[model samples]
Target: MHVRHWENSGGNIWDKYTVKMFPQEYRDIDKIYEQALLVSNYADNAIALAEKLEKAILSLEEQPYRGAERKYGFYAFKGYRQLTVENYIIIYEVFENEKVVAVVTVKYGKSEF
Candidate 1:
């Protein structure tokens, strides 16, 4: 992954972290997309939802701390954070020393899983 660096108006360099998704996260997202297609029976809607989720996840590359600390359920004591995209909650953790944001999981907000 390529880390992006940008300059602010004041000529300050802003470092963008690299974003990585766990192998399981990829499988989970694929399953979510498949289930969405099955439930809605609409390819377009499923595609749109997948794209939106991807966009939100990618945004972490530039703003890794944008999501609030996970203080409620599952992984709450593990120092994980969460970013919500539509009905899905993206769980992630930031490794500031390595300048990387790792996505741990993605779960439907309404589901207990």
Candidate 2:
């Protein structure tokens, strides 16, 4: 989805990136919501957490490179970037040629896997 536009400091318009989520991204978030619901036993709190994660993921359209590069674990040096929201970490990559920000996956921050 094309979430927003981009403008530089000098008011120069830059190409906005299209944010695309992989199927795994959706499943990862759903898992988060389910786990949250299991723990808090509150649907509203779980929904709020999921919404916050979605908002963070959508914000990438404005600045795809804002996230920190993955420097550890399996994703290290793989051109992946990570955005942390609450207890979840979002992994994505930016394809400048395509002007697309592809959300690769989401994982619980505290999980070993």
Tens-place lDDT digits, model 1, residues 1-113: 33333333442234767788767888878988999999999999999999999888887877899998988777786889999988899999999998888888999988774
Cα lDDT tens digits for candidate 2, 28-73: 8999999999999999999999999988877787778999998877
**Candidate 1 overall lDDT versus native:** 0.83
Question: What's each prediction's TM-score?
Answer: 0.84, 0.85
**C-alpha root-mean-square deviation, candidate 1:** 3.6
Residue pairs in steric clash, candidate 2? none
lDDT for residue 75 in candidate 2, whole number 0-100? 76
Deviation in angstroms for 75 in model 2?
Answer: 0.8
